[model samples]
Target: MNTGDLHLLTGAYVLHALPPEEHADFERHLPGCPSCSEEVRELAATTGKLASAVAVVPPPVLKQRVMARVAAERQAPPVVPRQSRRGGTRRGRALSRFALAASVAAAATFGSVALWQYQEAQDARDAARRTERRAADLASVLAAPDAKAVSGGFAKGATGTVVVSRTLDKAAFLASGLPNPPEGKVYQLWFADGGSMRSAGLMDVSGATGAAVMEGPLDGASGIGVTVEPAGGSAQPTSDPLALLTLPA
Candidate 1:
């Protein structure tokens, strides 16, 4: 499956919510993509921790309240059926037509309201997901045994430092004390063998200490550099590096 398909179902797969068909599809793709597998494990572990922390306490009167409401609703007068009456008169036909129209209107209104509520709930879930992702990222960085702070020179008087780590599956870069770029520019990190370069991460230099971090697979990087580039960054550096550091392995 394509990267888009894998990402689309990653969250569901992490929670084990996919149907059998989709589960098989995700399994087929996982072995070929280490990044997807790592993200899935991170998400699943976070979700499992959350689940374990939650207490299960059904409301004491929940069943009774529900059954009482259901009974009351059942006792309510039945909606008049809209079928044509046998040997019906004009008035009877008019009543049936009115009832039919009312029923349709009610159903439409309820459906619209339900749709709106579902959309609102979905928006809430999206926001919660973003917060969870940010938290997970910070947690992962904090938990890494190899993560550490390092420093280097920048333009003339400017200087910067970054937290760096090389994990078995991925690399993480975090920098601070760097100046922000021009309005249309951004800060980008590069992986270099001292002579050649590869884009490591696209970054922002606006935090209090101008902190930004990127996590990606880099099994072959030898050194690292930071440069100022266009917002989305380029495949290669187009300007002199503002900071540079060498990776251990």
Candidate 2:
């Protein structure tokens, strides 16, 4: 099978749904592809946990009752009379078509669910990588010898701190005890010189606490300011800043 087809079978392989022939092919490919290997491992572990969580024991008499029913079913007479050769051929063809359609439908449903789950797993991995990068940037700024800290509150209850590396032109901001913005509004950051301002980044103030790291040429900036703006932020400050911190000369 091609790579695309083989990737789609990762979910099936984990669930033991693939045929023996395809299973062998996928096994050969699994060793060389880290993405597929990792996905299969995660899916297999999740499936095992789910299986172990729901353990149901049949009643002692359940097997005996099932065998009795099967014996009675085997003894029942056929509902339809034996057909002529041509009629038997037509009936067989119809049964084959019905079975094929049902199999296709079931396969489609399974493939869609597997694809969705894989996409969600990929999204989670991307978010985790972004968070790791952010943490690393914060650590670097904190460790810099020239780093400076500025703290203030935009409103009565909202307070935040900005840590800047004077030699590196990087900053990390952390805020806490902030109220949610008004409808259709968001918090935006700006690097301000004496006469003009440039946007540093935008922030979501929905939570009581939020943090972000900023990297740019900040040598010319005289101060950092925060303001309420429309979602996605603005090119310039459209309203008065809620808080401002002047950088030391």
Cα lDDT of model 2 by residue, 1-249, tens digit: 755456556556765778999999999988987756765675565445433422243366744663454335322111223443355445433443333233334444454566667678889999999889988888988789999888987688788888888787887777898777788988888888778988988876545887777646686888888888998889999999988887654
Candidate 1's displacement at residue 146, Å, is 3.3
Off by over 4 Å in 2: 1-83
Candidate with the greatest lDDT versus the true structure: 2
Cα miss at 107, model 2 (Å)?
A: 1.1
TM-score of 1: 0.45
- Model 1, span 1-249: residue lDDT tens: 544345345556654568998899889988876655665665455444433422332365744663454334322111222352232334433333343333333434454566667778889999999768865775676467887656566665566654555563444555545566788998887777557987767765555245444546555766678888887889888998877776654
Lowest summed lDDT across 10 adjacent residues in model 1 is found at 73-82
Which one wins on TM-score?
2
C-alpha root-mean-square deviation, candidate 2: 16.7
As for candidate 2, its clashing pairs are: none
